[model samples]
Target chain A: MQENFIKATAFAALLSASAAVGLTGAAQADSIKIGINVPQTGFAAADGTSALIGAQLAAEQANANGGVNGKNVELVVYDDQASPKSAVPIATKLVEQDEVKIAISGSYSGATRAAAGVFQEAGVPYISAFAVHPEITRSGDYVFRTSFVGEVQGRAGAKLIGESLGKKKVTLITLKNDFGQSLANGFKEAAEQFGIEIISEYEYSIKDRQFGPIVAKVKSDAPDAIYASGYFFTAGPLVSQLRSGGIDVPVIGQEGYDSQKFIEIAGGASEGVIITTSLDRDSDSPEAKDFIAAFEEKAGYKADMVAASGHTAMKVAIAALREAGSEDPKAIRDAIAGLTLEASTGTISFNGLGEVRKDVQVQVVKDGNWHRHSIISDPDLLAPPEK
Target chain B: MLAFELLLQGLVQGSIYALIAVGLTLVYGLLRILHVAHAGLFTLGGYIGVIVTNATGSLLLALLVAMPAMGLLGIGIYRTCYQPLLSRPPYVALIASIGLFIMMEELFRLIFGPYGLSFTAPPLQDTVAVFGVNLKEAELATMIGAVVLIGGLALLTLRTRIGTASRATVTDPKMAEAFGVNIGRIRDINFFVGSALAAAAGVMVALLNNLVEPTMGSVPSYKALAIIVLGGLGDLRGTLIAALALGVIEAYGTIYLGNLLDRDAIAFAFLIAVLMLRPQGLFGRA
Candidate 1:
């Protein structure tokens, strides 16, 4: 018994010694560690991969340009599997173990929101790359977002449909999730102001691929347009089925349908379908053009909005680190709150609530690719909540 | 016109369910195991169909390759995973089946990449007007394929020597062995037919959606399990009817009670009602 006790004590001592060494090692290293939480597996793996590549490209570019304050920018990535259960543990590890200067979430809303709470509690500055849940920034002052919240995008969709497209009658096909519910809520809130009449609202689960009943009902309603919210996997089937069911109204979607895979899955039915998203593929801005070319070349596939958002988040973090001129977490957070820069997605600026304030970019499927439809630049209409 | 369209949509959806659940029922009838890995076979068949169709641009050729390949894989699974645990409690085999299903999903993701694959040139995009209701050609093909395949299966099981042997084994494997019926061969044939049907369902769904995803089998897997239970567990004819009935009910419920419940929730609610009213299922012999 005494020998076993001695052995246990020795093991505990060795563990503490190693942990101390690890801390010193991290402090001495000439690198600014940025924690990245992304969904490298599960249903959202595709978007996660794009986001990871985008962040990596930004880091590469920063290091190539003499690094951030002469310290190389290093990303420590963890796969959250797009689950809140996974994100909590990952965020804790990033804060307590890695002691990263800042953390970025390149995952969905649920996972990002979960991670945001952990980072906020630890007083580590956190930025959401593309996850659009409003609750994320509500976590704390340390939490910020680099993308449009679902409500902002949805409100833009209402404007695009009612005022821009000159369509007054609308039907809403909502996916029953945080992403969908928020988008639907925003669209409904702004619909009346745009003189749009909501004919009907239908809700479906994320798992549903067959929208036969919804399509039939929508056809009967025969609205001037349809506003639907779903990712590419669900959107593709929904659009195809609606078209095949002989409902040829313009289908408006949000960032969920922003992938090229949506077009490929929907086939010819994708033509004329519009969405409110971040990345403007037809942008003439040098930042957008350079980022697009670099991202596509590095990723070995077409750059997506998620990728651009991830890149933008990393660029923001680097800029903050440079502005602070030190590795202090509190200083980094203050710098991030005050920093403004041009990114591939848009002009990046944070509101009082850490929510981004930028013009929503609208794109439409034409000639088998997403092209710029119009830009919504109404400051009063697009303003994010301060508190 | 709306009613007709809903009915047509339900029938098409039901046909796909029948194609999927028939295989699950067959395996359960013979082995008394849930055979959850059957869903994995369906996903594998979908991947096979997508790969072959993309390479050859022929849906027929894709079907031909996927069916036989999945049949052989089904047999292999039985030989390696099920045969060892068959003598033990049925739960042992069930646990192994679930593990295999999860492993297969991961394998698919690792091999095919996490993103879903779409057919380069999916056929039957144009609609056909049937009774003043527009139906896609793919939907028509799905209904017809289910009819032909299920009909062929009915003939095979009702009027053949192998069918008699298979039925004998399902009733009592020891008795069938005593009567000189090759029970092992019957088991092999049972798995072969079941897996082949699952492959057909997979390819049909892939074509219908024009999307093949790794987790596509997940929803169908549990749904098929529920269907078999709703059909009184291993009653083939009852399983077929239950699948079609569930499809129709879901279509109607989706429109009527959709605001109150999701499409899947509506399905389970109907299932619960049916189970409470008739514990032996709609067509099961009580």
Candidate 2:
């Protein structure tokens, strides 16, 4: 009697499992699956949450307007924790198990670059939202980036400081990481062309909140401007220390400092600080303006570059899905490569290497908020690598 | 002028290190167990300080509330996590402490959110010029606080009955127990005082950086471990000197060797060299 009962339970479980699979199969017929990998529970969780919200908002808006080819867009999300090891399995699961048509990475360079290889190997088109590592796009033609590469942004920073701000003597404070190294390289390469002289360069780790040594050295050097590479966590303390040290010169940062939290952390010292980024808080473009409004309403905070990048990636994906007229991975890849759509971040287009091609936006802190400073649109200087 | 400024900066940084490492050294002197979770207590103190300060708009009240709260928590940790494991090998307790630290960090992340919290109105944004060196008010506060608290601790240990009891317990717990020195109570006191010092350091660091996050204690945790070892394990005075020396060395090395290595790498390289030359530590009574 007990054996019969156990057999009956097993048969019920098998029947339910098949029914669940059948339900999913039926749902999959009218929906386009897009996988998203983000660092939801790690050091980059704040940015990851913002990026996820931005992507979700984009999907919601797309569905409201009628999804690609009359099919609802479904996002299969996973937490990468900003680690390469976590991202690899996530990428594989998204591609193999879920059979997602495409994937977007709203994570740091390490995780994004690692996942890019898996997506490439699986022949599934992948888009990196904001990771700036140069190697990410090098993964394959199947991978694309919707944000400025570190080198391009770094070059833009050089131009912003050297020409726009007219600061010839500069001190470079490089964060010891891929993001910082790439930016420093681009800044150095363009510094000479822009007639800027780099007197000294100092490197610090991401864990360092204290910038006493660098501040003292930079104060002694007394450069006309300082170009530093760091995210808000590091930049906030570094800038505060620099200002409190009485070395008040123009500090140029990259997209990493493009968050309101930087202002809060730096306090009054954030005033006059500038950064080269994609999102312009004072942008007059309707697309950017609408995105800012919608995102603020949805996320309940001021939109940052990461959020804008995530939103832009999703919009590009939806646009590509529509352009391809089907869910074929190759067709989606071709459409993405050929498409040029104005996004919340900026005008989005891909180069031969799947790197983004667009002018860099410069924003400065004024009255505790980011405002437009200028635009670095030098085509020759800002042109990304084609291959 | 640059040298003077760097020196002041180093002293300020060193004072914070001393405050943090003193607690770890005291705990080791009493229990012979590495208190890796002390770093977690430091992080918790910072979170409590920030939350309180933001709510009360008074830094003093924040510090007052955080110290006792953390002191109690430290005692609780000793009773629950360390007490049971104390019977086993030292490595077992050390491993448990490390696990506790990681768990505390994750708990902080889950409770406070991944992004760090900033003081609503951080004090010491103004600079005061002294001897041609501009010092931040926050730095000055940290230095002064460290000196007073550490000095008070020194007096208490040297002049008070509890100090004698603690030293007795440290020297020979079994003998001290026979001599009517409550060894368990002394251990509790050791953890309470040590954790309170960590709390002070945590709050000061949060003020100094104007940002507090879950992983803020990680660097200081390992650095304190390196420092206690460098200063001779269980030696408070040695830890103090080692902490200051490290801060100054880091200040100088960052400018000189920064291009060659990272700030943390520079610190560890110095540690490795020191350990190789003197395995007993800088002041470990060789």
Candidate 3:
């Protein structure tokens, strides 16, 4: 009865505050701020925007449902522009001034690492939404990511292209950045395991607006599949030019091209492109079905890997908050490390390195939509599934 | 077969670089200003071309719309920013133009964000088999367009009255005024011509690469700067020849260096060595 009186008094105060205001009221004043960063204006902006929109939609929906223990959640948005040069300053500003106790972000691996330094120095826990580099998870104590690293995705990716597709010969064309290099290395390592031969390995710069020479080389090699580990900027033109060059084969890629820009660039011609990504919305799990329905309803668009990663990161963070029974950074960090949340995408429990347990999904870009299929380990794809 | 394909691939990529580099050379040659904003102007042209292409699904319309739009912008920049500072110190104009570059870059970013806009390649997907070599649709068409444009510009400079006037004024501004030439008019027209050439290259790049970003021109700009210097500053024929050579070098370099070397560094090292040996440039008069 004494606890009930205290709760009743708090409710009465919140109601009185709502009554006295026209625009500013209980909702605005009682909001818990969460810092959000992404490349809102650079090469990776499309993916960043999609992830941000999905996360924003989730935040809004959660707020509608009385938010994080009945306190409204406010997202403090900042544009990192996908630069380490810019991300450091933004992270500093968010931490020092806005005082957001928790943050969820990252697009480029480099930018994430740069911000991770600041967050670690300040002892703030950050849940990275989509940085795939292994170095990011290794930076410091406060850094954790819901997305799988490029190494895991890379090895899994190569296996999917080589073994699942029954491809014997392949061509490797990728950007020479860390993100691209890591995937190439993973694929190379996995190739020996699967007994696949790489016919040609062509490297291109992110600034190189031409892929003709590389595609031409790939064509002459006559590989069964062309594996490109780059974003839409390079892959879109490379595949189109390859087809135009009269060399048509299946082109497999990593998770970088998972954006509407890919479809927009590839157009109807992107039929045979296969890419490896995780957290597919069309996954058969009941939680995945609920997430897909809810995400589509809230975002008015389909969920992809980045969105799935964001959902997982948020759930992990919030679950940690609940387990700790306090919103402090130390409590949240311990809580997150010990969290075993059943996210819509999959069950996630981080190891010491702060990566989700190893499991990946392979998706094919066919008829202009991401079609998810059975996991790579399923031996059925090699033969035929009984319809 | 692979070697032949790689070289041909290099030439095609080099052709686009040459086209844009020559445009930068033109603006630099006529205006004696670095015009750091040249790349931004090219990006704007690309944006205009993209919108036109998407709406009409016509390549020619996109090029036509983008060309004039970029020309008008060039004229505006000249009259507003570069013209008023004509009497001030060269350093003042340099600073002002730099500021203009920042403003233009931010404006494009505000409207178009940082993501590259996807542009569908036009109806030139038909392949031409030459001596059993399969040439790409858009690449061959672009090379043809670049050559024709370069030839036309060269003819205009040598044969036209305004072209002669521009040359005469740059050589001796006071003498050209005394000879009854409208120097300002010639400068304005040169800006239009130069900017149009850049915008044309911009549209072609979008078609070739199938993507356009506001900052795309920076790479071509540095390359053009190197080409201009290597070919002989203020030497159009030299710029053209040097651009082709740079393209071949880049292809070989990428093949060898594995795209790990800085493009500017490679172009600079070769150009600088050439400059140290011949101070006036390959085509520049001593």
Candidate 4:
């Protein structure tokens, strides 16, 4: 009886304290709350930090333009550390405690996929900035992806390798995970369509620092080119090791290789390495020019593909909020599902699954910078099926 | 040619493992503490080495600065974390060291902004051919530096007065203290040297991989722990042999078997087999 009395007293005090705090919060909360989940640490820290900067830039631009529905836009960011375990709690805090109306994810596929379920159950619209896994948008109606899916980019890569570059024979070095395998699957499926023959395929763990043995295998295979799938950290060293091993054929990579740090780590070996990514920094489009200038001016470095996706995701969110004219998450989700805007990457429109349909830009590293080589556009790739 | 290249690659990676595992073994010999935070020191050395390299644009300067910096840090760690917990159980010290490791990683994240730093020296970019195998100047330097440093350490332990004092303390601290050996001072010197060796390995890794991250030391450090145990707790020579053998086995395993069981699988497999055969390690005293 005494323990129950103490518990009751403590609960009353907690209620009163929270009520006071809640009143204060309601009085001062003039800005519409948007949550951003990104990895600020771990293996993907470099990409995560750039994505954070891009999201911040978008929020700043929206505020400068008087924000959505004439209210200031505020972003509450949580670092998932690129792990699903960390992302789950951050998602809960964003919805249950922070009361954020919407969320934008700038993390890898694992964290984004994990957090999408949390936001969906809570009726919050979750926009993925750059995670390309197809399962991400398939989670729920509330889950949306502003970036192209992995299969789209992979298909584009195969088309570029076979049709444009005329590389008939290729050796694939996949990173052995969802992002790598999904991309590789798309590449394999479309390789035959473009008359490209996959000579050999090999897998490498993400934790691998040395590529000597793998490169040796590739050297012996001696295909026309090598298609490597991995992030900048692995991709950079892979290129360096491959070149140092005297295998100098054209090395094609996925969007994971699209970072300035890729050039930094690979050094001169990054030159002539081709990759297919969603964003083209050198594009003459007004959206590209404006975003590049603003992001670089703010971040002190050139924006990469992931960064552009962050900016577009936030812009799309704010636009949806403006059209909805309220803080209702379902209305915002509806507005976003119907959104058709010209984003930094390309024209942004969602299919039934909320995956973005856009052109993947083929870029090649030239003289320590990414130069636009060509673009592969597929109209039916992202279109929703006719009812 | 492929076999030859794999051997060279294994030797380089094994040399780094030898440097790291040897330090852990040395600390365990004297303190009886696992010293898990030693990995944090290795990571710190890598970060500091990168900073110094960028500032000075000299690989030599980076090594010179990083080694001493880590040595000083070792002394600091000993004074604060280890010394206070010395009177407690050895396991207490071990657990505290794990805490120190976590704290150091978090501190690094806070300071370095959680981004991986690229370490590059312009002069080290050139490739040198040795025995018909192409190697970057940085890779060759790492191999040569590891050999010279290990040899120098062996000589120091076998010949020098301080080395003898360290050995005396390690053998029997109470007896050495009773004989006026100042065991505490010997332990400090031991930590300084061991930490310096780890720092050298860290800088070499940053140079070779061209990337230095805050969490990079954790895995290598844990692997070093496995090496020390597989080498019979505190056996230096055994550690060296095990390190090299594991590196070669991993390289070959990744090539022959699929990458599904390449790195940790090969190391642990060799370890389990060795344990089944000779539980005291390759060169360990039974």
- RMSD vs true structure, all candidates: 5.4, 5.6, 9.5, 5.5
Where model 1 places Cα greater than 4 Å from the true spot, the runs are: A1-28
3 or 4, greater by DockQ: 4
The lowest-lDDT stretch of 10 consecutive residues in candidate 1 chain A is A19-28
The CAPRI-style docking tier of model 3 reads acceptable
List the DockQ of the predictions in order: 0.40, 0.40, 0.30, 0.32
Root mean square deviation (Cα) for candidate 4: 5.5
- At residue B239, candidate 1 shows an lDDT of 90
What lDDT is obtained when candidate 4 is compared to the true structure? 0.84
At residue A210, candidate 2 shows an lDDT of 96
Clashing pairs in 2: none
Provide the global lDDT of candidate 1 against the true structure.
0.89
Off by over 4 Å in 3: A1-27, A286-302, A377-387, B1-4, B89-91, B259-265
> If you assessed candidate 1 against the hidden native complex, which CAPRI class would it receive?
acceptable
Ranking by TM-score: 1, 2, 4, 3
TM-score of chain B of 4: 0.96
